[model samples]
Target: MNRDNEKRVTPNLDENELMNLMVDGIRKDGFKNPIETTPAEQPENKKPVIREQNRTERISPTEYEEIFFKEVKSTARHGKSAYIDPVHHKKLTRIVQVIGDDNITIYAYLYNLLEHHFREFEELIKEIYEEKHKPLF
Candidate 1:
């Protein structure tokens, strides 16, 4: 390995912009790791915090009309099956068909529904789970 000829390239970006870029990259790529910042390092503007909030919470969709009718692509990941009432299943399928796009999958809509439910009841679910479960230690 030659030690002398390597040229280090550093991007001429503001520290705040660099951090924002990293955060955006992580979000776009669906990386789960949290980016931690001390109070002093935190940006003066609250825009980043608002941007990082859950999409459903930030949008605060008032009705199914806002959330369910949007066009979305199918997820690449495999999903586990949970049986529901046949009526419910048929209703979901009908909703997708009504969208007039055969390419959309029922699972995406179902996933969005579950996401909304979980976000709405997140605190209660956490509290109940903590109360019910005892540590094995």
Candidate 2:
């Protein structure tokens, strides 16, 4: 990233355009894990901080839209469930048939439900840990 080419992200940018800019910057500047080879060693002179601040300037909105989504095909992107309750499975199948599999709204609803419960379970686990590991002092 060059200072002459750098542009600040302003509040005036629309949601889609801002997301495109962020995506473009991320896709172009893939992360290099500093932990892979050296955890004990440290870089001198704060090079990582400087590099982080020097983000690539966004391209034009037209070009941003052109590179909107990077086609990342990965086997780990999908998962299969072991089982569903027979009644729920039937209902889900019917819903998919009626609304089509590509519909996002129903899927988002299901995802949100799962996400909310997962967070709840996380907090419960933390509480259990605190109960089991209370400090004496």
Candidate 3:
């Protein structure tokens, strides 16, 4: 065969030709037909697993009594006011009596009250001790 007279077979491929060749290679490599999936069929709406928060458990009657008496004893020892206010001690005592043996409720109530009072005290102290400076104009 004369080299110049023989028809030349050019194997250079375009992008689409290259892609078809790749697909053919993949089919030959045992991925003959990929399974078709629809957007709705896919798990797009799946929610991630999350843990639930632990709830606070109720306190026992003995614990409640212990806490109540301890507060009383500590107040007496510190010579602190027996109530949230001096004149309102009896009314406060009645309220405490009404809430007796309910440690969880008592604790929550006390925590809220203390938080409010502490914030008020902090504001008072800030106002009392706050620095005042005159502008040197």
Per-candidate Cα lDDT values, in order, are 0.67, 0.49, 0.52
Model 3 alpha-carbon miss at residue 26, Å: 97
TM for every model, in the order presented, reads 0.45, 0.27, 0.26
**What ranking of all candidate models by TM-score puts the best one first?**
1, 2, 3
List, residue by residue over 1-137, the lDDT tens digit for candidate 3. Answer: 68865677776657765676675564544533446656566575643334434422655766655544334213234444334565565654555667653333333445455654577478755775665544579
RMSD of each: 19.1, 19.0, 28.7
Over 1-137, each residue of candidate 1 has an lDDT whose tens digit, in order, gives 35544665665757765676675664544444458778788778733443334655556434554575555565636667788799998988887787625545677777777777898789978998999999999
Error of 2 at 79 (Å): 1.8
Which candidate would rank higher by lDDT, 1 or 3?
1
What CA RMSD would candidate 3 show?
Answer: 28.7
In model 3, which runs have C-alpha deviations exceeding 4 angstroms? Answer: 1-75, 81-87, 102-115, 131-137
Give the Å error, residue 93, model 3.
1.2
Ranking by lDDT: 1, 3, 2
Q: Look at candidate 3 and give me any clashing residue pairs.
A: none
Model 1 regions more than 4 Å off = 1-63, 70-77, 99-103
Candidate 2: lDDT over CA atoms?
A: 0.49
